[model samples]
Target: MSTSDPYVDLRSRAFAIAYQMLGSVGEAEDVMQEAFLRLHRTQRDGETIASPRAYIATLVTRLAIDQWRSARARREQYVGEWLPEPLAADPSPGEHAETADSLSLAVLVLLETLTPQQRAAFLLREVFDYPYTEVAEIIGTDVDTTRHLVARARRRVRERRPRYHATRQQQRRLAGRFFAAVEHGDLPALEELLAQDVAMHGDGGGRVPALGRPLNGRQPVARVLAAMAPLLARAGGVRFDLTKVNGQPGALVFDTRGLLVAVMALDITDGHIQTIHSIVNPDKLQHFGRVGNLGDLVRADPDPTGDA
Candidate 1:
């Protein structure tokens, strides 16, 4: 990919829109490829595009909307909790603090509650900072209708959004302590780090065992994590690497063979962990790296004692 390549210049912006809209890296990349192909075909046909950037944005948004409609049904039928694919934190052009927040796994989960059109309108206006007139044009709706869509989506997001915001340093420090506790099975330390109302959501996608419902409150979440830590350690070959997921503090779990087993994203706020999102579904982990067979690993013989 040459820096001078037009697609190279537009990839970041186009992917930001598509990924936020669909919450699936694979699907967003598909939309981006299709958009680029369309742009190329149009140029070959001697059609003039006044603004290639805007045209690609519109193409990606509309395509993502269509993809989301189809994906929603599959999600409804999904065996276990559905979560957006975990995104590795990589700096990209035009990605400011606000843009990163909107890309967080927590916000993506809230965006799932929105209708396709509402999600598109809201993201364009709120996250990407697109004007109302341009948003209406992109979504093929009247300005008034677009406003209504954004308004409804905004209200819903506001109601569910995290009330406390943590600076990056605060998040990293808190998350470090949280993961350290989990690894050492320190129940008290874990409890101290978690918020009173903290919740933990796991997405195993029915391929592996996971909590069928979210575990709420500090005590329950702490106990479950503490118990599991020793079990994982005894199983052998399990390692945890701290990294950023969707611009927030997170950790990646790998098996004995160093294949990815899970991606955990911590929602830290006000110096405590507000929520914990663990993605164990292999399908979702594929985008991050080689996914280990979590089921097989869990089924293997346990060391009976926490030994290497």
Candidate 2:
């Protein structure tokens, strides 16, 4: 089997770029297909591409940029909240570091704020470590413009980022405490774990009775949790399973009937859970069959194993 293709090794990389840019597996796969088509059509013309991987990357980025623009418009028309698509675990630990670091859930969600060019430039430089000149070529822009775009994008990210420095260790700890509070239905414990200005947002698309708008302030969040306690107690012995959503610590819950119920994600700031994103809308939980890990489960219900 002699194949004249160097890009066989690059599909995952191309897919990664598209997924980060478009936030949809289907869209990413479509963009990658288009990129490969372009390569097949252009390579036969005796065009000398230094790196097939880089060439394909440019094509995927362009396609994803267009898709992102349209998606943003659709999100604006959405009935309620809009959320980033969730991702499952890699299952392969060897590839984990690359996928985990590049697709940090919070970072991907934040990248939604950038313009296509800004996002391409910033991600290439920051995530891929590409030089300005190289990134300029990848994005089909001049180096000066690419530099400026990356700079502006970086500044915007810094400004919008939570005040506390985010680290995997701190996120793990906060997730642990969150599970403890939810399991016990302790408002004070829950309140103490959340920042005073903590907020929770969910994009269940009106199917689930979410807060509709972002729940701000610890008091309001506490009240909501308290109100849900009886329902959680009565809801067919539901259990939470800790999982990673989009590579961040989160949870997925299932009722006793073995039906998926909720997907919860969080953003930790200053050692407290600053944002609690609970996705109770059933329509959105179709792709994910299970939570990412134990942290992901416990956040949804106290019993992740569904044995309770």
lDDT per model vs. reference: 0.85, 0.72
Tens-digit lDDT track for model 2 on 44-79?
887877788778878888888888899888888875
Q: For this target, which candidate reaches the highest lDDT against the unseen true structure?
A: 1
lDDT of 1 by residue, 1-308 (tens): 65587567688889889999998999999999999999999999999999998899899999999999999989999876788998878446566666878878899999999999999999999988999999999999999999999999999999998654887777778888888888888999999999999998888888777767778999888888887775676678477888889877999988899899889998887788998998888888888768886666655532211221
User: Which has the greatest TM-score?
Assistant: 1
Lowest lDDT sum, 10 consecutive residues, model 2, at: 290-299
Q: Tell how far residue 257 is off in model 2, in angstroms.
A: 2.8
Taking every candidate in turn, the Cα RMSD to the unseen true structure, in Å, is 3.5, 6.1
Report the Cα lDDT for residue 7, model 2. Answer: 68
